[model samples]
Target chain A: MTQVSDAPAKTRAQISQKTLRTDRWWEQPAIVATLLTIWVTYATVHVFIGKWYWVPQYHYLTPFYSPCVSGECVPGAASLGTWFGHLPPIIPYAVVSLPFVLGFRLSCYYYRRAYYRAFWRAPAACAVREPHQKYTGETRFPLIMQNLHRYFFYMVILISILNTYDVIQAFHGKTGGIGFGLGTLIMLVNVVLLWCYSLSCHSCRHITGGRLKHFSKHPVRYWIWNRISWLNARHMQLAWTTLGTLMLTDLYIWLVAAHVFSDFRFYN
Target chain B: MSYKAALRVWRGDHGRGDLADYAVEVNEGEVVLDVLHRLQATQAGDLAIRWNCKAGKCGSCSMEINGRPRLACMTRMSTFTEDEVLTITPLRTFPVIRDLVTDVSFNYAKARQIPSFTPDPSVGLGEFRMQQADVERSQEFRKCIECYLCQNTCHVIRDHAENENAFAGPRFLMRVAELEMHPADTADRRDIAQDDFGLGFCNITKCCTEVCPEHIKITDNALIPLKERVAGRRYDPLVWLGSKIARRPRSTGTPKVPDNRH
Candidate 1:
């Protein structure tokens, strides 16, 4: 073993000087105004004009269900419209995106590090910075937005099922009884993929699993519980996946809305 | 793509220190610590690095990568873009030695200061049984790997160094809460938690939970509950009245908060 020495020695008071300079540039009125405007405009447009069609309309290229008569099979026909019944609606999209956007803006990693730089450690750069200012009542208005995760989980599950229906509808495209479109299938795939990603989130898992202190020792039930716990263990993966899929879901819809990608073909 | 990464090694000891930069070539899978080790082995043999397991299981490899408190082994080189310069430094809560290693003895000292578990042996082994629910409550706390990421990320300690003497931080509060909730362990750490451990300092920002590599809910589970217990003593009118009434000349209420610091 290499000889370890107490070469570095300092009193607690002495180490306090290692504080570093942080930036509050984002808090500047101009920057705040610009960010608010962009966010507000995006929300307003997505809510009123876009009509949440970006997620539902472009979902067209997935195979969900096939009518199989034992060894024999027939394709089932179901359009995206039949599955979703109607568009997801713009008001709900705006209501949902509003908090998510604000949550990301008001309190996030960037602003956190920014505050750590500006306030906690000041006038010098240190390896360990001081704790940023405690956001006392901040947990109320913006942080309460986190509570929306429960509702978001429901949306994710619903959208996923709706998308799964679309995928199944693709496989059963037997006749013109609302046969599946590739666009709707893609949207369906998008929802299912994102739903798998979202449902397995840490917040969701904790909301469900973490609250449970005891369960009857039934091997069958315990097995299912353990599976959920296992999913919770990989919550970070789910977090990243949900983030990615949400973007993809929006992009697929946007391109179709803009007529950038005119046709989305399922079979190569 | 190969990018020129800066290896800012702390050359001098505590008083005299400077961020000396060494340009090094980095690959996709190589981590910040990997780059540092390469620098130490080839470029600066005398460079000081406190690392045991590169797998991130041991907390020995904790350092600030580009001004973020992350386990060096877990940090991938790919996280940084080509044009970015990565600043590597020792943990802030502890004092730095030569380079990336800091004095983590503070954690050990704090741990020692907290009263250890004393099982009520009179109850006898197998005599005491608790519901699976109560046991499970503390089980989540026992999962703490003691990475001190919670300690490091805790604003009470990370920002206000003075709180170190009084406050136990989020990590140890979880310890106190674990002990307090234990069925067999018959010691009261509430007062000590309030005064000495500085449980009130934690504003429940959950920065500790967020930055935790182990992802323990130090704020939600441990610290908040401990604070509530302390508040029960200090403010809860009903509990305060009960404690006051139970104060017979012979009957001492809960054990006085134990002296934690040696």
Candidate 2:
């Protein structure tokens, strides 16, 4: 604490601040790093092992493979037509859109801070200094790409819309009738959380509703802005939730597609 | 009825210091500041502490009780068990002047760096029309009492002394946000925010929001929106080119003050 004595009175000496925190400061960042690493590992493995990311019977597509661009999609699974004729074997169909999705998260304000603090330990917690002599911020080359978050925000909206379509398609089972299943619910929850994350984005909030002159003139926009404001308040929570559910949605389809365990179908 | 509590308050100057223990009697409704006042009245007449309203409103009594930044007048005596040693210390992020007092002129210096609201003259002659809806969020940000609690809690400059030159902590950031979001304010500050104010330094850990006594959503509402403005206008390749084209000598009548937005 800063203490400059006033007058001729007894006062102890002052200490320069190194780390003023007393609680378990490192524990939170360590745990966040662990959780993020697990998610990243799972995502990387699944993105590469891409075969089991689809369940043709349920029209269920894991987020990693949504807008499944490769012709290798299981018969009838490439609901969106293959852009290039089916890929040569070995390459995953999901590779096409995954970059944009990953970019969305990488450029996310919350995740940017999370990884910067947790992984890089740049002032990891309140009142704890990093070893670095300088902070370049997101100003240079690759880090500068973080400013593309607004564009990434736009792309995620498009990807989320595609995911929404896949989820809608999931409602129709193999028999071409409305169906509900563990996988359908999984895709549903995944899309919902994805929307929450995207809509809660600071960029999304700003574009859709912020920086306004008269919200009164734009009543509908203002209303949506307020609801989004509610979501943005918990943006960090939704960001983490989307990651967990995104992993679960992919895992459920992976298991069901691999026939490791059949999807528990409720209706078809 | 009164309860006995042991208080370990930091006592020192810039040269050296340690925790000095004081046993004080506290009433049920009293707060940490009341205990300090009691300590002043009874045992330690020479002890120094900063305070104003004695209520939580003025924000004059901001100090860390235990490890968290808070208003000493707001934290209740009952919140702690009688045995817990109440560690009262000055705000850790600043340099101390005496016990429980740190020189917060750093914030004032940062405040002077900001340009005040400059409205577009074309809008009106005297009156301006702002929809309540448009002004709502700015109103929330205006609730800030300048307690600097959020500044004290913010990590951007708290521990990283090197960042002090570039980064303006949560309080001034909120000020910028309030003005930027103002309905009539038309001066473009996006580039200034990014390049000068170091808006990119904040990672939005929410510690500032957690410590705010006024419940301002410093991270989500102000800082993040300000960031979007920075990202939207300042870094866009097209806007970058456009601004380069529009760049001219700064005699647009807007007083060529030495771009103190830093």
Candidate 3:
């Protein structure tokens, strides 16, 4: 090993500085914005479609309509009792609980990084200036609502459980006998993916265990936290896929309800 | 076997230059810095590369090895195949003083921008006592050796020179995190962090974490948690109500504005 004295303390001129990347920096932010815009538009319009979120024949309720807490929910479609009475005109049962789910995503550390850059253009890319001059961060007003992410995480967990219940209920055929179909399999995939997205949250990881002083004292928690760390590494990937699977699950259910095609039943 | 490897080294100053090719002799278990030292010793006597503590601790030898910000002393040459030509360059975010050495005054400027720890005077100087657990949280961030690699790889300033005025990059944000985590520090830095230090500029990309030789969880443990703290206190309605209650004097019992008008 060379002696530390070998390292010279030569300070060169503070000449011009910048990256040599000739590639346009705007490309990344552009792609992120485009994808987010498409997803948001689809979700917004899909949620308010006010129909086709469930198929009683399969007992499969698309995630967006779960707990279908509206007086207007189709008979037998309301998984939980309607609190606000049947759906009020145009406002779907999903909208009531939608705020909590949306709040979870909005406050998500991962999604916050995404939309803040893509939509808000807060330094849209590395080394680029933000469109706006001021930044109070989440410390101010609505942005501060991000702190409510943990509370929203709890609601999402309950909703995920409800969706799981819906999937189990799918096992019961339309006539109330045990059955299986392709829709059941699709719904299964959707709920599992949603679990991955919800459970991999940093808040979840922290709750399972973080800020610990002694690992040996609480071996079980340490073990669980170790597993969560692995999932957290792929949180973004899982989050993105859950979005796709969710839309697919809903679309499949919608098609079944529309009689576009009958669900392929394997058992009855 | 002593084999010769092609090294495409960037050989110029801030104004201009291109990758200059060289055939350097390879030996067993040698890092990139060793090869550069040999290159300077036997061939390019004046070839400039900044380094200290060939053992990767000092962090004085940050450079772009194949376009990634890494310590020259730590990047093992064996990581590359014999036929592969290793491309060496200075960190892209800062101005180059010479080959493989960048002007890191930008980091020093940021360090100055952060307020130093302000202890509560009641505890008296050097009398402050922090619990073992309290100090451990901050110990994680104190590992920084000021390699500035995190600063360089941070995209916030790497591409946008315009962002230099606003963004403090990851290294300094972790610095602020360390201080704010201190049990004895009396200052409220939430405003300084988000508003002035550009804490909001970081989008938790983990680029800085990836390049940190210290392996600090810069994005997760530091930046994200800091954002939570700033938002948590303000967003909690209970805290809001508590603040409102604490504002009026408890001695007054009832809320009343004392008459000062004469």
Candidate 4:
């Protein structure tokens, strides 16, 4: 009979240095942190400001206040009738859909990597040590809620439908005829990018073709899954691009509503 | 067209280490491993490095060249500027065994944890059949060379040592993904993939894919599909209710009779 013994576990190299990577490993996480902070701050302030979110002339409603359900919403802005009475200023105008939108992005597979690296530093980058001694990842209570991404995805689709409706409504001319302006173009672009981001989602790809044991039996689903997989390959890029477009659309609407400048009207 | 290339190779063991610089001859069309081989032959013959086949296919000479995880056998010397100094280091994710060689037993341990392909016992060997599309779905992952580059580059285990116990890194998870997608594999791997193998830990950063010499879309094709499958089993309420109503018991050890109709 051969005898076997357990060997002592080997420890990592104790070089004292944090990381031996000579390259600028901090650059990516730093840039992500800066951009996400600016966007989140701008969004939080704007969501609470509750003013200059709607341009009544051209039916241009900022995404920040779309489906404006509160009584506090300005006249003509609450296209989807005000469902709630006047409330505290802390609450956003599109309170009904905002949480789901936030949840959708927050639980996104791509965004999860972004914030996990930038905010949590569960690892800032590959080969770089994170600050935390222990990492539970999304296996625990709060992080485990990330699994609810599919549920959040469903809600965001409904909100996006409302956003599409808002864009369609934004085609109003000053005299009630068809209107086409820079705001219309911006909102249109924003909604298109929004759809791209939503459709390219990992959850969307899975829901489309994941559980199917055979691809040949379900040709239509297989085709759709292939398209979604192509889009899903660029989910990270779409995730960031939509963020930029969302902010750009809102900023344009805000500026127009505040009379910062008139909408660049091509036809009215 | 040979030139004198300056090389900085990390020299040390598990306890401590530092970069030792040397000037070596680099011939045209040569690779980083070639220069290292010459260096090992002429000077510093005692220097330790792991390599075999000297070809990229073997996935043996994996190291960080200029801070990127790559197969040294595949990296050409001409990619860098003439004046640039080539810095070679061992994979950061594993404990160093010697100079440029890391103890990759972690991957072996992870590989051991995964249950082998559990084809239905009723289906005789060599009698199993599968659709070409289904075969192609997992063929991408079959190209893995066990380089451990993906395992080394994956941030879940690369940075977080504690995560080693939970996360199996991209390579093994890709293995699980491949087996799970196999038409004949009757093992119910969704729960183990989530609970044991740590599929939830992967954030789909594509680092594994980027480092893969095989270019096996480890993130997009394998990990994400596995995640969706796991989500179908665990998260989707309708799927859960359907399974329960259908009285389909979650099988663990026993392989289910293969359903050829799929």
Candidate 5:
């Protein structure tokens, strides 16, 4: 509410006007379609291969549970071989991720801002006026699926531990070679996806001390954490990471559930 | 103690601008804005200055001194050396109309979009209860003076104008965050904030907090918490399931930069 008064006003000095480029060329339908096509296709393929082959082949842990031979598996499971014969724990993973993915997708505070910048005003400058874009329901379903992040974070950690335990169980047997199971593989991939998501969160970036003026000295021996916070200084990086990884994790799980290739097994 | 200082003031509007020099005599306890008024009364009777509640409470009298955003009324004239000249200009973010005044209607327009408070019918006024901590969180945001200094200093909207379409700026974001965090508030403006108002453009630079007159942690306490909630909702799978079970359709409204996003 700045105000001006009249009384023999001071002489005016003119500022030079520059021709501004005012169009959001990136958000055009053709571009949007191309980008989305590449993104979804890449995500679908990665999830399929990672869950089915890569995780099971490389990581000792698999998504499937093994049966109890001598109280090796959970109670009531018959043998070490029987427990490794079930579907990946989809219910637990989905249940844990529900709140995080759904809550944020419903709220949508961050995505709106991110897309506005990433799409419409990619190279942000001073004073470029553009009409607001009418937000159709395109990004909703996956955004609704975003609530899975926190729960995914929680589940992935738990599942990773479970997979670790499965690895230990494999060694206890005579073969000593960790056999791959589908469930252990899914859990392992879940952990990786969750890591990509959590490390990119806006909150986690701050805890890492992004752009903070200074840090305190008292927390002893954990100085390493403080140093890493410095690397997490770029706010936009965290914003993008948190955004992309959350969406990717959901895509991963959905693909696993869909069984796109069908051999992407979660159990023996 | 008596003091002497030179004031370099921007004395015109969008049509013209200049730094006019003036000498001022004041006591150690006086404020810079007070000195400007005095100089206006004696040396330059035609000079116009806008201010209210010379106390920092009203948020008026926001001006820049030596290239830094400040409340003229809150700045101590004693901080500058007697030989030094203080350069004063209206806040840079807004358009100057004549002198130290500019059209700030843009902020008002943004404020109008926020959804008003809507309490759930189940929690009647009489039975409503919340722990003291929840109430305290909202109290922190109540300190804003609307001086627009935070708005002025924000690089996203001030230095980077392209962000105006999506970014609601810091002041507005803090206000919305406040309301959203209110224990009794049932309105979920986060969707609106995301889709329309542009809360995500902030990037958490903390420059807004650095220049805030009242020292409210606009980024840390307010914006960041709201971001967490928004991010949580966007990604939390449990809430998604709950919405499905409860049959609550996802809201599709544009987020408005509410009067206060605290």
Candidate 6:
């Protein structure tokens, strides 16, 4: 490296302080840590609770238990068929899909930034010094697994299709007519947000139009790419929004299933 | 509307420093730079500062105002309340030369590391014709004033001095993105971006984007797209399989321009 004339003769200033920033730099990371911890704790407990995940009357199944593939599931809840027989309490009923969902969020570009800053304290905010001395980032071993985000993207697409199917089945009424209710509306909103989040993924954008030499040649792909690009700009917002929607959808179903409150029927 | 604004400016050389307090005159239309200039003129003539184009365009007067990276020329004094002590400090990411000036050669070094745009051999000068859409794709990045605010704000090199040798911060990474997106450029920058430039170190925190004065979506338009382009070559299994089947060399020196380009 060529040393320029104005290069600093000394190393970084030997100030014995971690940072000179006086702003509330820690607030953002603290909020992120608190929210993520709460979400993870809730998700873990609900995934294992296994009961009150289905309401047979309204066909309202919490996303946490969708495609509930166990013989223990309520008869109508096992829409995808019970591939797994009665298992021990340790495993989740949606075990097949849960890992892929977890992997999708774990490897998402936006979520990666959130967790890395919040949980890992990788310079929690800009200019803040982190505790760790050596930073290899995603170059080696466990972190290199982040490159599998594209694969997780693919898996999440398949799971989204299944989630869409669950939404379709959710149209059932108590009287067996086409149903529309508060549960249906909540599930509909959740599924729509899920699609928005998935479609706006960086991997999806790449698959749609990336690597193409000329946009003129692929008009169809170009159109889709442009739309995805718009959504891609809001990927961070969509990521957090979907998490909230997913929890809300699951919680609504859990409450209905547990008979905490009856589903508010808009029509039957 | 004129009053004495309490200003705290970091003072000292590369060896050591501490914040020095001053009461500088401030007028309604004046900026932080104006106040600093007044301080320099009246109180301390020896105070060191670097500035060019008192307008925000030159990007030479980058400093931290109350722990935020900003161009002193752009920050109005009216934004601060009367009681608030306006603390101006040099950028934390780089070595300070004196008060409010740091050796930004770190950015220049990173800029030198990136290979410049290598146009396709087939496309002669003046023969290059680009669609408007294609031109606009990279034009957003061209607005960068090289303030190095993005560099100073990026946590990769800011906190971890060890990673300085590898990571090329957001500004130069955006430069690579610009070249990579250029329809005529032929040289493959994906490998160099991931391997040599330490693009992986950027976890898309968006701090660079947040600090950008140009409002360039550095994380969205440049970095993420560049990362996707790299992934297409390195990680996509289908692309890997197709490349193996076709027996095509990865870094062939030809641009991927479609034959339709006139």
In model 2, where do residues sit more than 4 Å from their true spots? A1-27, A83-92, A129-131, A176-178, B121-126, B238-262
Residues B1-262 of candidate 5 have per-residue lDDT tens digits of 7866788888876747777898878877889888998888889887777798989999888877765678889999877777778877777667777677765655766666666666777986789766654565577788988888887666665544445555667888888887776767766777766666666565544557767889897876777666666664565556677788886555444234343332
> Which structure among the candidates has the greatest lDDT?
6
Q: What's the TM for chain B in candidate 4?
A: 0.93
List, residue by residue over A71-103, the lDDT tens digit for candidate 6.
798889998889888989998998889998999
Tens digit per residue, CA lDDT, model 4, B104-222: 87777677777788888999989977778778878888899999999887777766766777687899889888888887888888888887788888777678888899989888788
Candidate 6 Cα misplacement greater than 4 A, ranges: A1-10, B247-249, B253-262
Of the two candidates 1 and 3, the one with more favorable TM-score, higher being better, is 3
Span of ten consecutive residues with least summed lDDT in model 3 chain A: A1-10
Q: Which stretches of candidate 5 lie over 4 Å from their true place?
A: A1-268, B122-127, B235-262
lDDT of 3 by residue, A1-268 (tens): 1011111222222224233233376787788788878888888887888888778877878878887888778877777777786555678677657888888888888888777777886646543435664454554466655667778988999888888999998886867788879999999999998999998888777667553434445679867877887888788888789878988888898889888999899886
In terms of docking quality, how is candidate 2 classified? Answer: acceptable
User: How does model 4 score on DockQ?
Assistant: 0.37
Encode model 4's per-residue lDDT on A1-268: one tens digit a residue: 1111111224454444556566788999899999999999999989999899988889999998888999988879998899999989888989999999999999898888788888887667766667876666667788777788889989989999999999999999988989989999999999999999999988888888866667777889989988998998889899999999999999999999999999999889
TM-score for each of the candidates: 0.53, 0.88, 0.73, 0.92, 0.52, 0.94
Candidate achieving higher DockQ, 1 or 2: 2
lDDT (C-alpha) at residue B153 in model 1: 61
Best by DockQ: 2
Evaluated on the second chain alone, the candidates' TM-scores are: 0.87, 0.90, 0.90, 0.93, 0.88, 0.94
- Tens digits of per-residue lDDT for model 1, B1-262: 6777865555665635667788888877888778888888778899888888887777788766665567888789888776666766666666666666677777776677666876776888778666675577688888776667777766555665645666666777888888876766766676777666666555455567766777666665666555545544454455556766875232223444444344
**What local lDDT does model 5 show for residue B100?**
78
Supply candidate 1's per-residue lDDT for B171: 78
How much lDDT does each candidate structure score? 0.54, 0.78, 0.74, 0.83, 0.54, 0.84
Candidate 5's DockQ: 0.07
> Relative to the unseen true structure, what is the C-alpha lDDT of residue A28 in candidate 2, on a scale of 0 to 100?
84
